[model samples]
Target chain A: MIWVAAALLFWGMAWALNAWLARSRHSGLRAVRIAVPVIFGLTILVVWELLVRGLNVPLVILPPPTMIAATFGGNLAILWEDFVQTFLKGALSGYLIGCGAAVALAILIDRSPFLQKGLLPVGNFIAALPIIGTAPILVMWFGFDWQSKAAVVVVMVFFPMLVNTVQGLAASSAMQRDLMATYSASYWQTLLKLRLPAAMPFIFNGLKIASTLALIGAIVAEFFGSPVRGMGFRISTSVGQLALDMVWAEITVAALAGTLFYGTVALVERGVTFWHPSQRK
Target chain B: MNRILPILSVVTAIIAFWYAAVVPMNIHGVLDQAERDGVVVVPGTAKARRDFASLGLVMLNPGQAAKSWMQERPRLPAPHQVAIELWQTTVEKKVTSKRSLVFHAWVTLSATLLGFAIGTGLGVLLAVGIVHNKAMDMSVMPWAIASQTIPILAIAPMVIVVLNSIGIQGLVPKAIISAYLSFFPVVVGMVAGLRSPDAMQLDLLKTYHASRAATFWKLRLPASMPYLFTSLKVGIAASLVGAIVGELPTGAVRGLGARLLTGSYYGQTVQIWSALMMAAICAAVLVGLIGLAQRLILQRMGMTGR
Candidate 1:
């Protein structure tokens, strides 16, 4: 009860402080802009900790963030194995294979108007097939290893990459293609020098999208079948065991991995598409 | 019709590819059966025979190649097998039957629509708050963006478990997970939509001495319609995925997710493929409905150019 009171008090104070900060002229300043959300995040964490502890919430229902951190620290080796199994072996390999294949297919389709017209819709249909449905089927096909997980990730990432690359290839205007024609450039040279460069921003958008999708596919695929060492396997088992802290710990790793995966893709995108209008901003 | 000819040809090409793939994918199993039956065309080891990939070798044993397409638990079920299963479950059986695809589809679709409603409502409300209240913009908007970075698959089970413990079960729990997935798109879209009113437009409103409420009703809300519908299409599709994911963790004996799980468990590849087809079709229907509604509403509003 006291904890609840303290939480309410803290929330009220935080609300007042944030409101004041938001209204102030200096709120437009960069530091203040960052500070508001940071402070807001801290306040919520504190409130959650206090309420859960003070209210004596069951550990299974909601493990405190500190408990999650402690579990993460204590189970480094297991976590690391799970991370490698799911992220590095499954997601990364699948992402590379899928994205590579998609880009190749996209380029091939771009060369033929017939292929583009027919294939894009078909791709969209396949993309709409839910990951849950595919994961189980892929697991059955490839066996209960990271191979199956990779297969799921491959399916999940493929269409988006293909669609984006296809769109990106078309980003080069007809006039620009004609310019290359005037220069007597061959198809391959025009593709390499003009089309591919023009396509970078769109391709990177797809990559950024796929990075998170790959992580998700890898993790979710494990819920179907895995060799006792993957994030999804650990998460499901821990939940069944009522080890909420362990589940939270795995979630933290997943969140961090997802953020880092997306960030890396975005960073690479920035480097590659530096001249694109969106990147310039 | 011209547009459809290419699509038909592409689909026909894919079906042909799928049929061809079935032979190679199921060859090992077929050969294992042949070895068990003591049909030794190859005198060497089973490994050598299995590793060998020649269409000519498969063609030599027409019966065995045919058997690959008809395997009870094939690595890849033929399209006809899946189509037949889909027809049987969806049309032949009673909709109330657990074996029926319609029943499982309903279980998923109910959660999806409910969650989409809850998500769209919450998203619009939050977006409105963020746009109007500077404090919410500062505090809630960043958190909303951060929330999406956390993968929904990792969180679905936790949400289900937590909600289960509190005596919130079945449709509501699944709907919450669906809402979690769908809400982000709506929020992002609505925020962009609401703020789309330019400074010049705001000044024009100010010249009329319009109240905040009036400006919102007359301008901002209408401006957000196209964006809202666009996000709703994405959100509805996402919500279906979420409902399926939520079903997976619980191992619920109902829903398309359940059908996939049960099929995989029993090695009923045809059933699994049928469930997948059902899910894809559901998504298409949902998105189509949203698109139809968008057109109707926009036309009614005299925003057909948009």
Candidate 2:
């Protein structure tokens, strides 16, 4: 089938391009590395369009890539609404609350050994609780609006952020703390000048991780219960109606949102943690 | 100041807080669960405890004064109640009662174990291919990551319907979905693990005239064990997720996933929560078991955690 041939061709081109990019010591390898996936993806889409049309495969089993693009273009309104409801209403709120609360709590725990011992394991236990199980309970407790989705996101984002912040709080060398002590820096002053800055890289690691988790938590929570407007809601219901086009469109939206979310966090990370060794060129 | 008391007391206080908070959350669905199921029992004790918590504010101060008191304030069946329910469901039932949580959990466990095996095998194979060939590495890695970006919930129903339409009904469809969801982590982890052996190590092997296969088996594969086990821990959890996700669309006869859905539909919040607890426990136990295996296997290989 032309579809199979196109897929192979596209995949082969991607591989070849990637290998060339990796091996080449040329100045513009960065541009080439980025370009390879783009070119390969476009080629696949073109081949997919050709193959599906050539084979006359049923549109249901495998819609042409062009058709999927058309659907994505046509359904911008619903897609935007789903985006607002999920990303803006649920995920963003939860990520802010969960990550903010974690940093604050990490500071508190850092201040007291007692709090450190008691709280860390509890955070671990909560993190270990599967979202699939907790999502429904949260929906029941918080009601089936964006509130439940936000609650699930909170639970999902909380522990990773906490653990990371805790680790980051410890990131400063003891010698550095000793220098501050010799300088007679106050508790808050020492925290502000040294430890908090030192923790940025670890904090950003948690942020990057939680960005994906927040999106996932919001989406999965919608599956358990929702008010018919979320991306998760649309995807789940559309599939039941066997509307693959709409489903793929919603997926495209989710993919875009997830990528953007992660990218933004990574960008912030690069900015905030520029002094960290990992950021060094 | 630098002692365990702070940690112990803090945790104890939190537990006290959770107990206090949940006491009022009225999970009485637990405490009243026995009576509601028409099992022979004392009903008044649970109701009395609820009443005591609400009306017995006086009793609390007195208990605080006296150190302890009687008529243990009724909880949502307490830990003991849930344990009793677990027993009634798992060990006590003549096996396969509709009321049995174990029956539903078993339905899920079978699919989880099967899917995990298939998924892990597929992941390891793909990892091998990717590690060996530069071409496969670039081509496959991106697709694998992109595949995960599409939420599994969106894909689960399509998998169920498509597989059914193609005359592949029943467990195979669900297992395929699980396998599809699970293999990527293994591939990712294994790739990193296999490459962890350095150029110097590879050069040493080459100097000894080690064949490609010998070097792979002795150096690459063994070096990959830590990464493989870490991925397996993640893969096992992901497979369980796949199994649970698989249940949603297929209209399966049983599984913890099914119980959650049905319980939600029927307003059986307690049942849903109980099933979720069971699933969490299963995941924890399985991940722990993998961790144990990692320890034993790595020790045998003379590799410590470092």
Candidate 3:
């Protein structure tokens, strides 16, 4: 019961403090606002620890934060292996291939009206195919290796990247194209100079989106069938073993990877799209 | 005029290639025994003898050389064979039959919808909390982004078991796993949406002496509608993924995950393929439905996107 109280109290205080921080006018006050959530998170963790101890909540259901931290510390090796297999071997490889291919295809499709309608629909249809159902089949065909995971990632990231690139390539208005045309700039020169630059923001949007999709695809693909060392395999096996702390640890690793990946993409976007009105702030 | 013919030709060429690939089934001759220089070859010897074409013909015709093709059928079942199997097993049998994939799909669908609702609700509530607080904005935003890096696929089963030990049995735990996987996207999208109103809009509302609540409803809420719907559309797909991931840990007997497992275990490739196709269809329909809803909502609000 006290655990419940702590959770409620912590959440309530966090909520109140966070609201004030959001409304703060001063830039310094804004900085303080950022800590509000962290404090809230810490408070909840403390309450969770206290309440779990006080109320005797089962570790299986809600392991105290400390236990999770300890478990994470203890199982660094397994977590590290899973990270390499899923992130480096599977998601990253697929992200590169899928995004690269999509961009190339987007350029081709842009040059041809025939491809715009015919190819886009096919891309759309394939994109809509759920990875959960396809991963196992792909694993069977590609064998129980990272190749299959890459295939699944390819399938997952393809559409979003394709759609965005196509949109990006189209972003340069007809007026811009006319200007290039009047300059007698060769088609290749114009494309390299104007269209590609104009398309960078849109391309980056697709890349950012693909990062998430690639991560998701790699992890989900592992659920179907993977070598013994991948994150997916450990996650699946640990459940039967009832290793909640280890699972949380792996989760922490994955969460860290996802955040870093997302942050990198955002940072790149800020650099590349600085001229865009959205980035002016 | 220039484009249409090229597209038609491409389609025609693909179909022609498909037919040509299938026609090789007729070239059947068993090399069970072979004689290099007209010497009589024993059945068990390196030399093999058999009417391979007859076997291929029998397999293809299923009557002309049935005996020969029986040995050759595994390479690829004839289209008719698969078609017959599809009809007899999927169409003729009722969904309640033990053979039905629909029954399994229903199990997966149940978990998906259950988890989706829970995740979406939690996400909205969290977004609300994060948006209303400054400290939360700073701490929670980064944490939320970080939360996603940890692959849910790896933790879904663990979530299931952990929840199971806590006396949260059956669907709820699985739903929680799904919700855990899905909630992040919704929260992120909603937070972005909630903060979408420009300072000018806020200032305008202030000029009217509007309270925070009034400003939120009159300006921010309306502005964020499109963003929220887009996120919800994305969330629904994520939820389906969550539900599917939820099944891997428990190996529940009646869901699509179970079907995939059982099919793989038994090498029922056709069954596995069809189930996958069905899941793909289901996802498409779910996403399409949300898109339709988005269109309706936007149109109702007098916001039209070409």
User: Which is the leading candidate under DockQ?
Assistant: 1
> What's the lDDT for candidate 3?
0.73
List the candidate 3 regions with Cα displacement exceeding 4 Å: A1-30, B1-90, B128-142, B145-150, B195-219
Docking class of 2: acceptable
Better of 1 and 3 by TM-score: 1
* Rank by lDDT (best first): 1, 2, 3
lDDT of 1 by residue, A1-281 (tens): 99999999999999999999999999999999999999999898889888999999999899877888899999999999999999999999999999999999999889888889888888876666575569988898789999998999889999989988998999999999999999999999999999999999989988987887898899889889899899999999898888999999999999899888887887888888889888775
lDDT of 2 by residue, A55-152 (tens): 88776677787777899999899999999999899999999998999999899889876677667766665565565567777887798889888898
Residues B209-299 of candidate 3 have per-residue lDDT tens digits of 9998898788877887788887877777777777766776676777667777777666666566566656776788888888888899889
Error of 3 at B41 (Å): 16
Task: Write down the DockQ of candidate 1.
Answer: 0.71
lDDT of 3 by residue, A2-35 (tens): 6577677776876676666655665266557457
The CA lDDT at B206 in model 3 is 90
Report the lDDT of model 1 for residue A40.
95
Judge the docking of candidate 3 as incorrect, acceptable, medium or high. Answer: acceptable
DockQ, candidate 2, comes to 0.42
Arranged by TM-score, best first: 1, 2, 3
Top model by lDDT, which number?
1
